[model samples]
Target: MSVLELARAEIRALVPYSSARMEAAGGATLLNANESAWMPFGDAGLGCHRYPDPQPAALVERLAALYGVRPAQLLVGRGSDEAIDLLVRAFCRAGEDAILVQPPTFGMYAVCAHVQNAAVVEVPLAADFTLDAGAVLAAVTPAVKLVFVCAPNNPTGAGVSLEAIDDLARRLAGRALLVVDEAYGEFADGASAATLLDRYEHLAVLRTLSKAWALAGARIGCLLADSEVVTLLRRILPPYPLPRPCVAAALEALSPAGQVAVRDRVEVVRAERARMVVGLGALPGVRAVLPSQANFLAVRFDDAGAAYRRLFQAGIVVRDVRRYPGLQDALRITVGAPEENDRVLAVLGDGA
Candidate 1:
């Protein structure tokens, strides 16, 4: 019951398309792929005109080292969103195979499944916004090709139990690929699921530089899994998925100085998150501030609409998560800079 058994048969047998860039490497004159003779104007250090490496080698090495995995075990993509889409395409056959998700979780899991015309089975999180591991394991069926778990889950901000997740992965061994979306792992107070990859051949971890690294606009994400699974994703991923500039930017972000800066920033965010929690707790009409291991906090207000308006009027923007299942009166607020967090406190306190 290997994880590969879960991948669509067609994808496993299909020979991936070989682009012009994939055929050859640098030599003298580049006449293979049609391109302008002259470089584009306003060119920075990055050779934007040339097709970047189908998979940037140096960047892959850097990320693999950072994530504590071998270079061969990673697949870099546009962002975690692209990784999510690739997983669905490779495993779930349209109208046949299915994927499971824990709702009030990341929307893209369901969105990508829908785009692939695959079935989506949702097992809602507990009222405390925690994973019901026993329930999630029971929901697995032969049709389930993928299972997405968002730890320190978005909007909810509660970190799912790692022990429970480990047990679930052990139970689902060979039945489905257990995908742990650790987008907010940097803020959490626990080890990553990547540590379990050595044991669980079916485990997949999605990480990004979007949040803690302050590179959201750069849109860099990595899918860490079994080397074989990584190769499967590569087969279907678009050639030249990353631009030259993006590769350069990510390299810089992973350097020693950049890492130190990210750590400093993370500490500031954690402090601000605490301050925001305490400040919001004192405000009237605030029902609860759910415990969070992520950088954001999910605050339940007695009147979410009024709370939203109050913040909007003050030019402070936070995610209004009322429409999400079970989050009717909640707002997900990312821990911002000191000044920004202060403004939210001032506005909300005044409203109370």
Candidate 2:
């Protein structure tokens, strides 16, 4: 069965709102959508006077090339967060269909599910924070319409193998859509699950510019899947998703020179991540440092509350994820620039 079959029939049948920008493209003299005739005082050529394109062709084409997918198979939006919301809104039915998630993972998956009145099923990662394919498959029921896997997962920084992804996708082929969140993919060692899209029609990959690309403020991201899946999402998507300046920022960042710079920065982050792992492990209060394939490290300390207080007192900010399942004693630290990292080390050197 097609993945489209899993989507709410109401959403599939409803017509999405069509903005004036989508219907009419180019004309020097503009008079549509009730847009302002004059730009803001400090517009600086952003062209904020008009509504932006729903999916700018250039940005979509650029992202498609960058991720090794076709334009038709990609849907760019505010961020991976928006994509997640759209998926839940379209697939899961209120109080009926559900979304499966491997927890101690990204929180947004569950947040989106609850907002759409969909059930959230947990198939948590192993004690060691590794994905168990067999365990995941055993938990899937007919009610599960979506399955979320976070590659180089957030907070923990553990990654799911592409082979395992392929296996799960194959097993869940007709039953559920395997959604792999690769927000931290550029920093991980594993290749993308997008590689298996050709084989599994029900698979989707969510990628973001927020992490490695340093485009978090730009709010650019995409969902890569079968072209048919992309078409189905468009039916329910907000018509004017990308703002003009944000679109320009994305285009500039995806430029050849921008990509070169991103690669260099990514390498720096990888090196820093490795260095932090060793450095953090050597700290006095740190009990354990989990293995990571992304740009951060999850370190378990003797006293998480004390550790958090010390860092903040020293004017350093790091995520205190003690509230997350299996992370009660852990603090997540992003690998900062050299000097910034030195500050973290110097401050935590005494072990809070």
Candidate 3:
């Protein structure tokens, strides 16, 4: 079955909101939406007087080129979080359908499911925090409509191989939409799941500039899927999803020089990730440092609470991920600047 056919019938039948921007493409005089005729006093380079494009053309084309996808197959949203919410809203009917996610992964999947009043089916990752494909397939009941897999999973940093993902896609075709969230793909090794889009029409890939590109404040992200799927989600998105200033920032970040700087920084993060893993693992109070391809480490300490407080006392903030299942003694620490990383090592190393 086509992915569009899997979306809620109500969504497919509903007419999308016709915004002022969508109505007229060419107009010198702005009076359609009753927006302010004059530009603001502190007008930045990008004029905020007019509503930005629903999916800004220049930004969309730039992101599509960067991710190696056509513009028709991509949808720009607030972030990966918005894409997740939109997916759940489009595919799931409240109290009828469900979405499946692997535990110790991104929490937004289940949160969106709950918000939609849809059931959340969980298949816990293996001991090493890898995808358990068989368990996932077995857990896929008729009610499940979407499956979110975070490549190089969050909190744990274990990635699912392309081969494993291919097998899952083959098996789950026509059954449900397989969404591969590559929020940390730039830091990890190997090609993106977007490369599999042509082979599996039911697959969608999520990417963001928050991590490697260092545009977290801008909140720019893209959802790459089959052209039909992209069209379907656009029906439910806001009139103007991206702000003008954010789009300007994203475009600048995607420029050649910005990209080069991003690459250099990623390499530094990779090196620091390695250094932190070894340094943290050697601490007297530390139990283990999970190896990661992402820019962060999931570290286990003899006394996680103590370690968390110690870092805070030293003015360093690390995520306390003890509440996540199977991570009671672990804290998630992100890779920072050389001196910042040194601060982390020192705080934990000083008789920690």
What TM-score against the true fold does each predicted structure earn?
0.98, 0.98, 0.99
How does model 1 fare in lDDT?
0.91
lDDT of 3 by residue, 1-352 (tens): 7778889999998899999999967777878988888789888656898888899899899999999999999999898999999999999999999999998999999999999999999999998888999999999998999998999899898877889889999999989999999999998988888899999999999999999998899999989999999989989999988989999999999998988899999999999888888888888988888878799999998899999999998898999999999999999999999899998888888845
Q: Choose the strongest candidate by lDDT.
A: 3
Q: What TM-score would candidate 3 get against the native?
A: 0.99
Q: Backbone clash tally for model 1?
A: 0
Worst 10 residues of 1 by lDDT: 43-52
Q: In model 2, where is the ten-residue run with the lowest total lDDT?
A: 21-30
Candidate 2 Cα errors over 4 Å, as ranges: none
Candidate 2 colliding pairs, count? 0
Error of 1 at 208 (Å): 0.5
State in Å the error of residue 29, model 3.
Answer: 1.4
| Candidate lDDT values, in order | 0.91, 0.90, 0.91
Better of 1 and 3 by lDDT: 3
Per-residue CA lDDT of model 1 for 1-352, tens digit only, reads 7788999999999899787688868677888778766788988757687888878889999999999999988999998999999999999999998999998999999999999999999999988889988788889898999999999799799897678778989999879999999999999887888888888989999999999988888889999999989989888999889988888889999999999999999999898999889998889999999999999999999999999999999888899999999999899988999988888888998998
Question: 1-352, model 2: which lDDT tens digit per residue?
Answer: 7788988899889877877976766788778788889998898898898788788889999999999999999999999999999899889999999999888998999999999889999998998999988889999999999999999888899988888888889899889999999999999996899888889989999999999999899999999999988988898888788889889988998999999999999999999888888888888998999999888899999998888889999999899999899999999999989888888988899654
Candidate 2, residue 58: lDDT:
91
